[model samples]
Target chain A: MRIETKTEKFDEPLHLESGRILESFELVYETYGELNEDKSNVIVICHALAGSHHAAGRYANEAKPGWWDKFIGDGKVIDTTKYFVICSNNIGSTFGSTNPLSIDPSTGKEYRFKFPILTISDVVRAQMKLYDRLGIEKAVAVIGGSMGGMQALCYSIEQPDFTDTVIAMATTAYTRPWAIAINKIAIESIRHDPAFKDGFYDPDDLQAQGLPGLAIGRMAGLIAYLSPELFNSKFGREYARTDGLYELFGRFEVERYLEYNSYSFPKVFDPLSYLYICKTMNIFDAGRNKDKLEDSFDKVKCNLHLISFKDDMLFFPEEMEEIRDIMIKLGKQDQITYKMVDSQSGHDSFLVEVEKFEDHVRDILKGK
Target chain B: MRIETKTEKFDEPLHLESGRILESFELVYETYGELNEDKSNVIVICHALAGSHHAAGRYANEAKPGWWDKFIGDGKVIDTTKYFVICSNNIGSTFGSTNPLSIDPSTGKEYRFKFPILTISDVVRAQMKLYDRLGIEKAVAVIGGSMGGMQALCYSIEQPDFTDTVIAMATTAYTRPWAIAINKIAIESIRHDPAFKDGFYDPDDLQAQGLPGLAIGRMAGLIAYLSPELFNSKFGREYARTDGLYELFGRFEVERYLEYNSYSFPKVFDPLSYLYICKTMNIFDAGRNKDKLEDSFDKVKCNLHLISFKDDMLFFPEEMEEIRDIMIKLGKQDQITYKMVDSQSGHDSFLVEVEKFEDHVRDILKGK
Candidate 1:
């Protein structure tokens, strides 16, 4: 499979949830397969935090496949053979999208902290614009997991009739306090780093000098993404050998794994973009101003499918169950389907348990 | 009950686990109530990580009581009325002990990273010396929780006949990989702080410049000390108001709580001391050089009482159950008692669920 990223510029001013306007922005997206004459086969795939528009296939210079390469190939679950799939980088992300690292056309400098805070709705609005540019009047489905799942839900509500189906996995309609606390700590870690310099550090020095803070934040996030059962089975009391001395500076295997992730993340992610994206996630609540959650769901006209992992500590199955019960109470049970994936990978199960996800996704796509 | 701290200097050298030796050292301890003539009614109360010799009562000019004031006063669970209590600051702690911040008698400067890494056994050895200085041949009991509980277990094994009873709470005989992983990340956070300067920062500038790293470490530790149920019940989705707006800089109540703890911790703790003590805890496997855990317990000459919290994520009840089963297999069940405290406070339940701990502790003290 081959993949190429393309960009589109929007000269129109876009209002943000922070009440500020982005004068003009650009979107980076990738498409798999061709759009049909009717465009009814179009499916928008949303990426999660730290993810990019490269959702499937590999670029010429890349060493690894795209983030969702396991599922979005020519014959995979979100098969390109039958569906025209579009995955775009979110506005506040550090990928090819217009993010804090991008230059401000008006100021002739990088936006950095000057970038307006984004909400889930703002991200959805940008992707909706991309849909319009491609002449996709209605999508067959909007599919995503975790933060991406939040965007899928927002797409269903923001453009009620544009998406015929919504597939959300390992996410909640409202961000919980537990998640907010974790995200706040992670952002604080980056802010406290002397190298961060209030998010105005030299772009060239950011990744090198701010690697420690970024890595620590990533390490904390990794712990939350994994389950105790997984950790126990994967690295239980296993010590790394250092110079044949396991007692001196040797660490547990899990520590080394976390260290590797923490170090490499800064190379690809902008610290300021990470803070902005996580803050957006912290404030994401579809029912923020509504009287009840049902009132917020009332705007979602698409048929809904919710999938939660049984071992996911972050987005628990109970939370998904609550959403199912709420939809049933709203007399929308006929339009809703809820399924739980029994996995040991915790919140990362959505990405790791390909077999379980594929079986359900294939059935849903077949309209069974 | 009145309590006072005292220090004893030893001119002789002390050997450490890292094959290093301190030329001279000092031990700081606090005593509550008078010791009996026979010295048989004495009980050594150990403090956990970041805790101090001030285990009970309020010091002059202080606004807050000791960490365990609720359970170690005149008529409290430890009962100073009946038993003489001694609480010593651990060897590698900043709380009036011979720690990294202590002045080296030879160099006339702080030890800093030059201080030898300590083991749980080394901490117990120092406390044992304190007992010898007080002319106590044997103690009625050695009681502690968390890291302190590790010390209590070490005391029972190192000097089996010196303590008649051991009460360890919310701890394990062997450090689990999960705990080692959390502690490693915490230490890494401190090491990443530029102000730390490889543990050689100016003493005067440490608390102010190195606070970010120390606070981040403390914040991470605080998360493990609490449980999900506790967070749900205490904070839920409650938001903190910022300038009458819950949207701009709004935070969860839990985030505010963690921020407060992170800010205040650096004021009293030495970042280097935190790293050393946490490392000591990470390597604190009572069964470390032994063929089996039972081999390590074979030396125990005292009755053992183990208490675990039902919700402790760090030291799971299953770990305690494993220890109990080992003792039963060794035919020492008659001398061992295991109890679980049903609480949602997680690892902190040993401190918060006072009534439950008190009941079990009092019964063990009464030899019931």
Candidate 2:
């Protein structure tokens, strides 16, 4: 299916959780299929870290489809033929959104480090305003995975009556200490790179010299997103070059794969945006003001579906089990459905193993 | 329990598997007790990556005891009272050994990258020469954990007639791809730091400007050494400062702990040594030339004991189980014993949870 992008500019400033305001911003988004007369057929799809507004289909000049192309087409699991699928780039994202890379109207220079820090709730609020402009009173469902899953949960809780259903995959309501620790190291890698220049380097020089730090950060993140079983099966101890044990630069296939990913990421993503999003993810807490997790979930009125991967080390399956148990204790077990998918993809199963949960996703959407 | 360090300089060139040679090198070691007649009670302990020759007691002005001081006291599990305990700093380590920080006699300058790349086997070979100089024909046992465990396994396989028992904990016969990937990123972090200057930076400047990269690398390594349960129990989501969510520099307790470790590690450790040792660890494979793992263990003549932690993500329990299963298939099960310790300390369990296996360690040592 062919896809077209659209943008809307909001002149009013956005009040952020950090008490800072984004003067004026633009939202880049894409729409698949037709919206019903009452706008009741709208299904909002949230993107994960490093993702964009392009949720599915191919553009005229693009070589590949969107990140979720496999599961969000006309006849796919999300089925654009039945519902209006809307995906917007989050405010702090680099992909055509009003991010740190955007020019500051006041100084006529890129925001960079001057950009205000954001939260997961702040990103959700920006999208909600976009929905209001598009005449969408409420979404049929919000579907997401990983960091996107965090946004879906935020929408369900903060905008309790805004969405009818919420589907979160491979994520937790609160940022885990283990996950935060890993992210902190990734951020430090970027900060320590001399070429980063405190996030003030020339845009052209950023990709060239700043790559070492960006690539290293991405490599660490990629390892966390994958399982040991997958790495062993795919790469093992195979050498990229064949001088054997004595070669200084002899590379493992796994190392080569990681390097390729690290090298390619900086070409498209902005470093400052990566840092901002990571900070937002680190501070996410559904029970920020509440004493108990159940108290936080008590305010979530949407029918909930939480799916976890068995081998996911970043967001363990036990966390989802705890969320389920909490809902049970609150006498709302009937309103939630929890499933653990047996997968070796780790936290990335939500994106890579879509076929494993195609029927379940279909059933959940059908209920809405 | 008052230990003293000793150095043995071997004038003869040491040959390495990497086809490089060290013209002359020194091995720094510590002894806890007297060597009995016939050297029948000698126990050689191999130190892990980044560890020093100081293995059991405290020095005159030292603020802390040795890394394994808790487990190697007079009446502890290893029982220094009954055994002569010797722990040597590996050649590539930053400690008082011939590492990259050592001056080259020919140039009067630090070897830096000019130093020969050493392997785990080379380190074991150097320790063997130390034993020869001490007039010890064989050791009662060789015990180590993590990289030390790798050295212990190498001692048993390569020097079958030299040791009677091998205690390998939180390690595998071969390096796993998952571990190599993590180490690859750690090395990249240091290399990307402009202050590193291709490993040619002055020592003073290195400690000042090169700290960011070193600290980030150490932080990444420290996270892998710990388990998720330990992080949650120890830190959770408590903030280091009380500005709540709005403060940009506000850190979680876990983040603060990692930062402290990263900062302090660079004070004594050398980055070049870290890179070299990590390289040695990444390329370690007992079955290097052999087609099957069982072939590698076929030459093993010493009784082997392999211990794995349930929470070790670096060296998963499955890897240790594979070693045991391979031995069982070779009908050498009688020569091998395997145990999986239940602990949330991850790979650090070998050092932190010594009490959990105190009796087992005592019994294994008594067997000799």
Candidate 3:
């Protein structure tokens, strides 16, 4: 099915966790299928870092379908024909959402550094507001992977009655040091760019330079998203252009792949939005304010499904298992389901290699 | 033993693999213990990336000893009393050696881009020249770890009669795609820094700026050199100073660790040297110019010992095992031995945790 993004302006002020007010904003989102009589078939999809609200279906002139098109279209895994799907381009995201580049009403300039730092809760709350406006009440499920998965779990914790089910894939309850280290490197890559000028860089400069800073971070993130085994298999020790081996700056096939994929990122993405969103992801902790992590989920009343890939280097299998064991230890085993997909695709498997774990998701979501 | 670095100038022209000539250069090196009458007790140590010639002994007024001081002392594993140790700072490195920042006699200016790109073979050849001048006919052994391991293995492959023993630790025979990808990211991290200015920037600027470019790459490399488990264990999810969590740049303990370690690097290290050395490391292949990898070791006469750490994420145990299997396939099993140390310290374990693998090295070197 063909789908179009819809932008709805929200005049209501959003009170963030940091006590900063987002006065006027717009939520860019998309929906699929019809709302059944009582609207029990609603499903909200949370996008990961660097992902857009475009979860499924193809736009008119797009070469490829939405990021999760294969799993959300008619007769697909989520079966848009049966369930109405809504995905909001999160605030602090560059995909037509109110972000760092969006103009502030107080002054006629972009928010830039003035944009309040965000938490995962702020992102979840913004989506919640969008859901409230869309007449989405007590939805069937909240499904997400990676940072999106954090949001999925957050929805259950913050508003236990918001969704009947929560499917979190390839993510952790709290950020680990390794993940934080990599993220810090990515942030530094952007900041060290002289053109960045402390987040006040001109859009034209990025348009011309093609995101030399963000490109480095993007390549790093892309590499982290895939297993080293997958990297070795996909692009072995072969030169894309081998004039000589001892030559300086010889191009490897993998280097070429990274360049090709990240070339167009800067043209469409705002660097400030990237910086702010990364901070949101970096500081995310589901257990904050609660004495124990188990206490954070004590009031949770939704069926929780933990999905992971064995080769996911970013959020490895052990991390996902820890969350599963925690839920089981908290005596919530009856409402929790855990599945590990044996794919060599790494963290990207949650989005790209869905076929490997679709059966598990179907069994949980569709009662198959 | 107390030691001092000695610099020897060589007027003879050196032919590089790139068909470039380095007319005049200096080799700065350090040695421990007295050479035997026959000079047969010589044990040459090849340094890894960012390492100095001082492998053992404390310099006057220095807070710490050499990088591998623990492994080599009067009665230590390598046994300075029995074997004379020599470690030469490679040509492309910083520490008082001829490098990219050194003045070129032809142009009377810093070599910078004029400095030829180096290979593992080229570095090994330079060390051979240094040995020739030092009146060392043949060494009892050549030992190294990480990039040094590549040189140790290269010594066996390049010159079959150079040494009796070649102990290589925590390294790869050939740089793989995963490694190349990371090296590319590190290169980009430096090159993208606007202050880098194509390696033409003034030294004072680097001193003043404290090498934001190199710092970013160094941080990335530091993280890669460590295992995730080690990082988690050493610096958990605690903030260094958490006044508030939602603050944009609230530092994690790991972040503080990276900043602290990398802060001192720029003052002692040259960014240009780092760039060229990383390139040398990136293109290293012990099997170069061979019909097969096994063919490269066909001429090796040394008792080769391969040492690895189980948790080395950078050069994982699998890569080291592959080389051992290759040696066995070449029918050199009797001449080759492999030992893997069960240390969770990752690639840096070779420098930091010698205790874990000292017994293996002692047995191989001392023929116990």
lDDT of each: 0.82, 0.85, 0.84
DockQ category of candidate 3 = medium
Candidate 1, A21-85: lDDT as tens digits: 88889999998987778988888889888788988998778898888888898989888887888
Q: Predicted chain A of model 1: TM-score relative to the true chain A?
A: 0.96
Q: DockQ: which is higher, 2 or 3?
A: 3
lDDT of 3 by residue, A51-95 (tens): 898888877798987888868988888887788888999999999
lDDT of 2 by residue, A1-368 (tens): 43658999988889988888988999999988888888998888999987899989887798888888889988898887778999999998988989988989989999887888899989999998899899899889999998999988888778998987999989997887899998887787877676778888777886665467777888888989998999988888887875455544467888889988887888788888888888888898888743667778888888889999999978999987877887888888887999999988999899889998888989988756
Screening candidate 3 with a backbone cut-off below 3 angstroms (N, C-alpha, C), the clashing residue pairs are none
RMSD of each: 2.5, 1.8, 2.0
- Superposed on the true interface residues, model 2 gives a C-alpha RMSD in angstroms of 1.5
Better of 1 and 3 by TM-score: 3
Candidate 2 residue-wise lDDT, B1-368, digit = tens: 75878899999888988777888999889999878877888888888886777888887798988988878879887778888999998998888889888989879988887887788899999998899999998888999998999999898889999987999989988888899988887787777777777788777776664467778888888889998999988888877875456544568888889988887777778888888888899888888843667777988899999989999978999988988888889899898999999988988998889888778878887756
* The candidate that achieves the highest lDDT relative to the unseen native structure: 2
Question: Every model's DockQ, to 2 decimals?
Answer: 0.47, 0.71, 0.71
Interface RMSD of each: 2.7, 1.5, 1.5
